[model samples]
Target: MDLLALETPCLILDRGKLEKNISNMHKRMKTLGVNLRPHGKTAKNIDVLKMALEDQAGGITVSTLKEAEYYFSHNIIDIVYAVGIAPVKLDRVVALIKKGARIALILDSVEQVKFVAAKGQEYDVEIPVFIELDCDGHRSGVTLDDSLLLDIGNLLHNEEGVILNGVLTHAGESYNCKSVGEIRDMAETERAMAVKCSELLRKNGLPCPIVSVGSTPTANFAEDLTGVTEVRAGVFVFNDLVMAGLGVCDESDLALSVLTSIIGHQKRKRWVITDAGWMALSRDRGTASQKVDQGAGLVCNVEGQPLNDLIVSSTNQEHGIISNRMEKDIDWDSFEIGSMVRILPNHACATGAMYDRYYITDGSTDIIDIWYRINGW
Candidate 1:
């Protein structure tokens, strides 16, 4: 089926670009001599996961238990729930463990460790765990000098039903880096921090086997991965405006886009309106702080080539307003009402969550496959 024939405001994935992105990242990780545990949170589809797992160690990192269950059901069992686990969510984790899923939980608090241990004991499961570390203070995790690091490690290692698997940290601040050199520095810091925490654990007579660290920017620019066991990156699978703005990927490498049609025009305001609004494109303005601010998205022709200086300047719940950044008048005839266009998102993960499936294409209008995505939780 042709992509234009499908309903407007849908997701279109370029399979060729997607495959190239995955292959390149795999090669990069291989060169660094670290295992690639691709995060499933970005592309929540099993089809994408299968392609990413190639040459990997069969372990996946997920932000939610639903992703863990969905991927586990597809036989990709080695999993890491990368978010700080809540006491209430342990039952679901335990259920997956009992079903033969080697799921690892990450948390930074002693309270979480106690909860996990109690749940594991009650369920008779030896739950694997990773102590989350704060590499750059971007989000959750314990600091290197924080005494809680050893406290949690000791509790996890000595607990009855919990096994301290290792340490994990994400260099989320890499996204804020202004240059590739900055990203490289953040990558080194991320790797060094995780490795140091692991060393500290081992120094205290505890086993720290898995040392994980990653974020798309850090993963792509890391010059070394000396003691790191695995790298977890997700947005690399579908480069967005944010990744492009960060120089982690070129704009041409973006593989995910929203397909929409021109619905109306305001010649007075030089606005080209479309059915794809924030509801379809998402409200993530991740590129706003970057050098280039791609509004809602960068407008593209039907062939996926970016239009000259065009962008979705604004959006309502169900209407996207396309305009030129230079404030030039649009060639109305070239974008007549009902003419189809594609929008490259600012954040692939956020935009992807607005859709339920991907209309796969090999860089063409001809739709080749329909890949379903899991949402919620």
Candidate 2:
């Protein structure tokens, strides 16, 4: 297959690879017997989202209301805004709900519960609410031991227009695990925590129908998801250096990459300057703390194969400094002034977020299609 001439710094999605990654995630979730409600925040492209849900019940998790609106407009009715909502965001949620979108909102506090309940009444809409549980102190979720879980659940259950749909948590800390054993332990912890929370809600006579546990690391290694209804993982569709560093998915499984072209070079410094910079690739150095601190991203040839130890060592807003990861010698002529290069991102979601659309190809030089994305909050 011949490569197509494309604009520099465009986000590329390898179609063949994209399907393989989606299939792997769905297969894992099926074996564990849980619904694979993939997080759409990773690609933010409907083409990818459509493929991710094609083999399963269609439910997606989103990080922004704009995403909720975008997917809803595209006919994906079952959506979960995974991020906790501010009271002001209810109007946006309600507008979608009123138009036939089943958007679930997540929250963690009693104050948020009250705010959701109040907004539900004002809009006369039944807001499906998921209480966020803190599985490992990684993010915004409330801890399992907090009394507010019961308090918020009770309030939602008793409220006129609000329904306590379930509890969801992301074992984000699982990403930091150094071994498969540690990820396994964290996955068990994530499952146990959500199950225990479900038990607590049921014990309190509150309806807890859904138990959601997420984060790619925990989802991949979760030995038992017996009590969980659904698993939310986004990055698996476009594996990143961070996931590769954690052994969640290999760098070869990275379907999303930034398409760049060599613009200049510094021979003495062994740096190959490219048109892709922090703006093309995101500023998320997720692998910095990992054992392999991929400066910006791992560099690949135009065919998307790794260029030995080459990586985007540094970047300015519109320029990338690609060099050997170990800072060894470089053949400056190898990367000529107009040659194309592909840079795999440290974080797929963050990197993909930088572009408005993805140039889709199947490891070929020619573009299969261009898929648009919904960016922003």
Candidate 3:
């Protein structure tokens, strides 16, 4: 099917760009001498995961138990539930473990360690876990110098059912960096913090086997991964406007976009409206703080080429208003009522969650294949 023939407000994935992105990240990890455990939260599709895991270690980092279950059902079992585990979810985790899934959980607090250990004991399954560390204080994790770090590590190491697999940290602040140099620094800090925590644990007679750290910005710009065992990144698979704005990737490297049609127009206001509103484009204004604030998304022609300085300036529940960012006159005649256009998302992960499937293309209008997404918790 041709792209134009597909329904509006649908996801379009360029196979060519997708392949290039996966290859580039894998090559980057190979050069850095670290394993790449691509995060499954972005695409949420097994086909994309398979492409990412090719010629690399066979492990995945997922944000939810549903993702772990889905990927495990497909036989991709070496998993890490990167989010802090809720006590109520222990049963589901144990169910997967009982079925032979070598999945690991991450937690920061001593209370969480006790809960996890107790649950593991209840199930009589040896559960693996990583002590989350706060590298740059971007989000969750125990600080490297926190006294609780040793306590949690010792508890997991000595606990009967739970085992301390390693330490994990994310340079989420790398996304806030204004330059590549800053991202590189953030990467080093992330790696150093994880490695230091591991050393602290090992020095105290505890085993810290894995040291994981990553964020797309850090993974792409990291100078070295000397002591880091694995890197986890997701948005790199479909570079978004936010990533492009951060200088992590060029706009042309983006593989995912929302296909929308010009539904109406306001000639005097030079506004071209589209069917893709926040419902389709996503409410993630991730690029708003960047040097270049792409309103909702950078507007492009149906062929995926940017149309001057066009952008989706504002959106309602079902209406997207496209206008020139520089206040230039829009060529109303060119964007006719039925003409189709594409909108690059600000955050690929959020925009991707708005859809159930991806319309695959080879950087053209010709649709070659269709891939399903695993959405929900």
**Per-prediction CA RMSD (Å):** 0.8, 1.4, 0.8
lDDT by residue for model 2 (11-78), tens: 88899988999898888988998999989898887878889896544899999998888888789999
TM-score of each: 0.99, 0.97, 0.99
Better of 1 and 2 by TM-score: 1
- Please give the distance, in angstroms, between residue 315's alpha carbon in candidate 1 and its true position after superposition: 0.8
| Residue 211 lDDT (model 3) | 96
Q: How many collisions per candidate? A: 0, 2, 0
Give one digit per residue, the lDDT tens place, for model 1 in 1-377.
99889999999999999999999999999899999999999999999998999853489999999999999998888999999999889889989998999999999999999989999999888999999999998989999999999999999989998999999999999989999899999999999999999999999999999999999999999999999999999999999999999998899999999999999999999999999999999999998999999999999999999998999999999999999999999988889998999999999999999999999999889999999999999
> Worst lDDT window (10 residues) for model 2?
1-10
Question: How would you encode candidate 3's per-residue C-alpha lDDT over 310-376 as one tens digit per residue?
Answer: 9999999999999999989988888999999999999999999999999999987999999999999
Worst 10 residues of 3 by lDDT: 49-58
lDDT for predicted candidate 1 compared with the true structure = 0.95
Q: Arrange candidates by lDDT, descending.
A: 1, 3, 2
Between candidates 2 and 3, the one scoring higher on TM-score is: 3
Point out where model 2 deviates above 4 Å: 1-4, 55-57
> Relative to the unseen true structure, what is the C-alpha lDDT of residue 250 in candidate 1, on a scale of 0 to 100?
91
Better of 1 and 3 by lDDT: 1
